[model samples]
Target: MSNCSGESNMSDVLKLAQKFNCFYLSGFRTSECKPFIVQGFQVGLIRPDVIKQLLSFPEVFHFNQDCVELNPAFRDYDTRSVKVDEVLKELKTKNVFMTLKGWRDECYEVKTQFDTPSLLKMDRSATCLFGIRNYGVTINGFVRHPEQGQCLWFQKRSASKQTWPGKWDSMVSGGLSVGHGIFETVYKEAMEEASVPDNLLKNLKSAGCVSFYFESERGLFPNTEFVFDLELPIDFIPVCSDAEVECFEILPITECLRKILSQDYKTTNAPVVLDFLVRHGVVTPENEPDYIKIIELLHVPLQTIYWHRNKIKENGFGANEIQGSQ
Candidate 1:
């Protein structure tokens, strides 16, 4: 709860939703009310009669004009029985999985056993329709100097990457897949992306989670990133073992901040680095006019999407895999 001191020049940084072409909906954008009435609200796009065909399975969604609302009852049924995954797979086969803009196939998961259940399993590819929440890991690898201050290590994603190709990103990042634990995924991504050894991995600090919801050409991306802070040796250099990264660079904290402000880093990477700068005193509350807003942007409320993780049964899948930093 401490405040940062710098007045940030990145005041024009895009809002989470606007960065991805999305808007919150309590009601229609126009003055007229929507045709069908529903209790709760949803995050989605104004597509054609797409929901009409999907409504055949009454338990999945309720359609109103061009808007589609996820049925709350789908959560009661088991994963396979609800057939949400099966339906999406079929849709993909028929080329119904159209992208309004460009495309990316970054994969993600949908847990139907949670609150609202319309689509069972959605990946990075199909999130546009329903705005499903996705989880991942991001590590801030840095080195401290007694006199010169802190330096951050950044990676340039490969030009071939499905999402954010050729953009500067956090030192390490990867999706939190269905069967992996936080620590396990961290270890895997660090080794695969940056070749970080287990010796250094043992020193990783869990800095908690950052959540944000955005809409992109692919779809609505509701993301929660489990952020880790790792203090690496000053001379340690990172080598990319996987084709996911194009190269690596170590920049002074100021350079990193400049890149973020200039929009040189990937869209999501800005918030992660901004949080770091604020926490480390690089950007203080006094200097940054939007300090409070930046702080709030990192922790969006995800109670409904995250509830099932707490209700896991003894025999539940990946139950043993869920835990804190190793």
Candidate 2:
């Protein structure tokens, strides 16, 4: 990529994870955000602007000093989904919210836990407005080269992508949308984004998942990415079969880390790949001063934030305690 100079301004690898989960770096005193309550559970952390806009639909949203909550009467899943969808559609017609302008026609299940049933589904792009807990899969495609050692595969996102256009990303990345399971998303993205064949897909190994709380100009991203490592034959090369990727490259670990730290790299996937490096021994506790801190940043306790509502309420959850739950 013309944008990459193979230079990184980041002095410590921990900085990458720190940047991703910046919500904690703020001293956990988030007075600007509001809790997005669903079915008596706090599902997302709503931003100030979004909260103001959501309050406009008084019939759909009600607020207490503690948080902004959905209508309690819309009890069932289907009813909540329909009511939220209707509001999202109206918001789409207006250009005030940039998130609605980038709608993918894809919906993300809004829930307290990934294994639990969804309370409702919302447009993927608009989920940020509510600081929704999003799930996705990230695969690190690699090969043990005879001469070059282990190298990682990277994809340049399609320039036309709504978010992070033309940025360097994981070999294969896909979201666990409304109906897709974790491994199912992995295979689906592997084929569509990198065209990895079935034989190589068998090598896909689940390393674990990385969770972080990120806030961007768009919204809060409490993302948990299930991580996988796939070892391909040294002779194999990736071919992009989908419009999502512009091209692919295979770079050794050192160079791959630099690419990750580059400005063109996706911030959300940084912790994902770093977890892979930590597991593969590219980054180690003996060598890196902040190795343990990086690990903590990659595994934020997002899954239990909603599950332990009382922990938050007792904490006096400044800013609705969603931000403090970190």
Candidate 3:
């Protein structure tokens, strides 16, 4: 076994585990010399070979015979290995695991078994679960004018936030608090982020809903977003909330699509809304490469039903009528 200088941090251990793509079993006591498998060798017993392997990998700080005890940070990881045939099957089904880069440096913690349910409420920490996390509702709407065609609206996200800070995004997008419904969340975000009134939002059309699982260099954010559409009068001016929106623009949809496709736009959330719009035929696919890439990555369907569409149709009403009924 490699002799530990008796001084190593959890970060060092995590780097080793990630490099080897190995499982880090935690919650083990140091008292027992449990014989466990380490690098295919039966170690922690009388066997010196296993100890040698463990020592060679300096990242492994604690070990026992039954299992190697790692830092708790890697406890809830998705590190299942697949055979070549299984990999092929996954690729065929479009269920391939895309590698997430840059998480090694981020601060992470193992969700204690007891804290799993409550911790899952937070957007950043929730993705560790096998289930999905409710980040927020994403509203996609249009500001129209008689002469200028439809102008797209986007909001600049707060710079103080952890993910996608200081970037432009959908007009009104935010996380749902613990007790709020999807509609209530969207309504609240629209009013807070754009100064849009609830009465005006009553006319917001339910375009569709999309569930996305994305893990990039930043972090994993699995979102079930409800897309809404609204048509405003040409002269309708949106007052920007400095906290949520840096400024408001009235660019034509064509210009918006161009900037987005070229990656010239600083908005991270715009591509998602644009992808939904393109799938619904609101925006042409020919000029939406960024949106197309997003659809491909998430494997979202070309078109889907708005979560509230059935109820609206059942009541024999449009968006305005449904709002009135509510």
Highest TM-score, which number? 2
Q: Please rank every candidate by lDDT, starting with the best.
A: 2, 1, 3
TM-score of each: 0.72, 0.91, 0.50
lDDT of 2 at 186: 90
Q: Which parts of model 2 have CA positions greater than 4 angstroms off?
A: 1-10, 307-310, 314-326
| Pick by lDDT: 1 or 3, better one | 1
RMSD of every prediction = 9.0, 5.6, 19.4
Q: Which candidate comes out best when scored by lDDT?
A: 2
Which 10 consecutive positions of candidate 1 have the poorest summed lDDT? 30-39
Candidate no. 2 TM-score? 0.91
- Rate residue 41 of model 1 by lDDT: 35
> Alpha carbon lDDT of residue 34, candidate 3?
32
